[model samples]
Structure formats: C-alpha cells, structure tokens
Target: MKTTLSVLVENHPGVLSRVAGLFSRRGFNIDSLAVGTTENPEISRMTIVVDGDEYIVEQVKKQLNKLVDVIKVSKIIPEESVSRELVLIKVDAEPQVRSEIIHIAEIFRANIVDVSRKSMIIELTGDKDKVSAFEELLKPFGIKELVRTGVIAVNRGNKTIKIEEDE
Candidate 1:
C-alpha cells in the first residue's frame, strides 16, 4: 500500500539526513519528499510518500518515533485527510498552438505563469490524480519541462496527531 507520512522535526541541519537515513537503512524507497517551514520557526514539516507493506510501514513509523529530533509522525491516506500537490509544466507553444493550449489550461483551471514566443509555462495545483490528468491533457502539445512539489496533507477538521510535550 502507498502511505503518506507527515513528520514534524526540529529545524536542525542534520535532522533531515537522520530521518532519511532511517528509511534508507530499512531498505525502503521514498517515493516523494517535500520539506518546508511551518508556522513555527523552530519546527519544520516534511511530507513523504512511501510504498510498502502495512506491517513494514507501521514498523517504520515506530522507529521514526524513536529518533530524538522527530517530534511527531502520522500516516495520511486518502480516507483520513485532504492532500494536494503542485506542478509546473512548460510546453512548446507557438502562435498556432498557443491559444489552444491556453484554452485547455483554462478548462483545467491551471494558470499560465510565463509565456515566450515558442513556449508557455503553466502552474497547476490539485490532488495527485487531478494534476496527472492535466499533464496527460497537455502531453500531446509537447512538454518542454516539468517539476512537482510532492503531496502535502492535513487531517480533517478538529482532528490531528500532534506531538505531546513529553514524548
């Protein structure tokens, strides 16, 4: 099964390396990882996606909790939370195809961020599936480059797995 893990850690330099090392040592491949600052300056949040058996994933979570710098960890799947990803795609576009691509992007609710005589850059943000669908729609026009910010998630209202002060 595929699982998304939201991890809160100290904003120390080596924390990310340690956490990543844990997964690497366990022979688990991280599918995607995005780390950024949260509201609190002393803390950083990481969203990681991994695919593995349920038992193994659970064990990994337990091991992660053992790390001193790791404040909290939660597995977020589709049923429990809302998840989103952001993507930027650059496509080949000239006078002939520019308008058509813009129309399609509008239908998908994507924004055109940059435009040159021969190419256009689009910004899209949505769930994984929605972003994939948009990419597919633009594939025929010729993609020049693509980049994505992996999944980020939060639990439903009024519910969350937060770090306890003592633990």
Candidate 2:
C-alpha cells in the first residue's frame, strides 16, 4: 500500500536533512517527497509518500513524531485529499510529428511550455495516473528528458493542519 503523510515542521535549515536522514536510517524508502513553506513563514509542509504496509506506516508516523522539529504528522487519506504532481517532458517533435504531439497535449490539457526545431517541452499537472498516462503517450515520440515535482496534497474540505499551542 502507498501511504501519504503530511508533516508540518519548523522552517529552518537542516530540518529537511534530518527528516530525510531519519528515513534513511530506518531503511524506509520514500517514494515521493515535496516540501515548501506554508502561509506562515515559520512553518513548512512536507508531503511524503511511501510504499509500505499499515504497520510500516504506523512505524513511520511514530518515528517522525519523535523528531523535535516535527510539529504534526498526519496520514492523508486519499479519498479526503486532493493530490497532484507536475511533470515536464521534452520529446522529439519532427515537423511531421509536431501536430500529432500538439494534439496529444491538447487531449490532456497539457501546456506546450517550450518549442524548438527538434523538440517540444510539455508541462502537465495531475494525479499520478494522469501524469503516467501522459508520459506513456509521449514515449512513442521519443522522450529526450523528463522531470517531475513530487506529489503535494491537502485535505479536500475545511479541515486543516496547524500547530497546537499549549494552554
């Protein structure tokens, strides 16, 4: 099973390193990890995806909570959250294939971010399945390069993650 964890941490140097190190030390492989500052400059949200069983997920959460920098760690339930990933693909676009490539991009509502005589760069943001489908379709055109921003997600409704203050 793939588990997504939403972690809130103090925004400070080395915090990311420590968090990543913790996973490494425990022999846990992170499938995807994206971190960025939140609305509050002092905090950052980390979206980490790991492929493991329920026991492993529980262990990961417990271990993460022990980190002093971690403010809160919650499992992002798939049905309750909206998740997305961004991918950029540079594919061969010979004159004869340019139009076909553009048509493919249009089908997925992907943007043609860059173009040159030999290749075109397509940008798409979607859930994993969408992104993978887009990539598979572009592969026949000869992919020159590919880059992806790991998944980032948030709860679908009014629920939010925040730091708790002691009274």
Candidate 3:
C-alpha cells in the first residue's frame, strides 16, 4: 500500500533535512516528497508518499510526530483527497514534426511554455496516472529532459487536517 502523509512543520532552515534524515535512518524510502509554505509563513506542509502496509504507515506517522520541528502529521485518505503533480517536458520538435508535437500536447491540454528552433517545453499538471499517460504518449518524440514536482494533496469537501494548539 502507498501511504501519503500531510506533515506540518516549522518553516525554518534544516527542517527538511531533519525530516528526511529521520526517514533514512529508519530505512524507509520516501517515494515522493513535496514541501511548500502554508498560508502562514511560519509553517510549511510536506506531502510525503511511501509504500508500506498499515503497520508501517502508523510507525512513520508516530516517528514524524516525534521530530522536534514537526507540528502535526496525518495520513491522507487517498479517495477523499485531491492530489496533483506538475511536469515539464522538453521534447524533440524539429520544424517538420513541430505541429505533430503541438497536436499531442494539445490532446493532453499541456501548455507550450517554451519553444525554440529545435524543441518545445510542455508543462502539464494532474494526478499521477494522467501525468504517466502523458509521458508515455510523448516518449516516441524523444524526450530531451523532464522534471516533475512530487505529489501535493489536500482533503476534499469540508474536511481538513487542522492542528489545534490547545489539543
């Protein structure tokens, strides 16, 4: 099972390193990690994905909560959360095949962020499956390079992970 954790931590220097080191010391490999400042500048949210069964997920949550800089940690219910990832792909796009590449990018609704004489950079954002499918479709065009932002997620509807100081 793949478990995703939404961790809130103090937005200070070396905080990321500490969290990563903790996971490494425990021999747990993180599949994906995305970190960004929250609405409050002093806090940051880390979306961490790891493959593990129920017991492992619980252990990870407990360990994260024990870290000094960590404020709160909660498991995100996949079905109840909305997740997204952004990918930028630079594809081989000679003039002769440029339009064909544009057509493919259009089908995926990806943005042509950059265009040059030889190649074009396309930006796409979606869940893991959509991103994977888009990458597969462009493989034949010969990918020059690509970068992806790991998954970031939040709960749907009225639910959320709120940290009450009093509690």
Candidate whose lDDT is highest:
2
Best by TM-score: 2
Residues 63-126 of candidate 3: C-alpha lDDT, one tens digit per residue = 9999989999988888999999999999999899999988988998899999999999999999
lDDT of 2 by residue, 77-142 (tens): 999999999999999999999999999999999999999999999999999999999999999999
Please rank every candidate by lDDT, starting with the best: 2, 3, 1
Sort by TM-score, best first: what order? Answer: 2, 3, 1
For candidate 1, list the clashing residue pairs, or say none: none
Would you list the C-alpha lDDT of every candidate in the order shown? 0.90, 0.95, 0.93
Query: Which stretches in model 3 have alpha-carbon errors above 4 Å?
Result: none
Better of 1 and 2 by lDDT: 2
* Clashing pairs in model 2, backbone N/Cα/C closer than 3 A: none
Stretches of candidate 2 off by over 4 Å are none
Worst 10 residues of 1 by lDDT: 158-167
Where in model 1 is the C-alpha error above 4 Å?
Answer: none
lDDT at position 106, candidate 2: 98
lDDT score of model 1? 0.90
- Per model, how many backbone clashes are there? 0, 0, 0
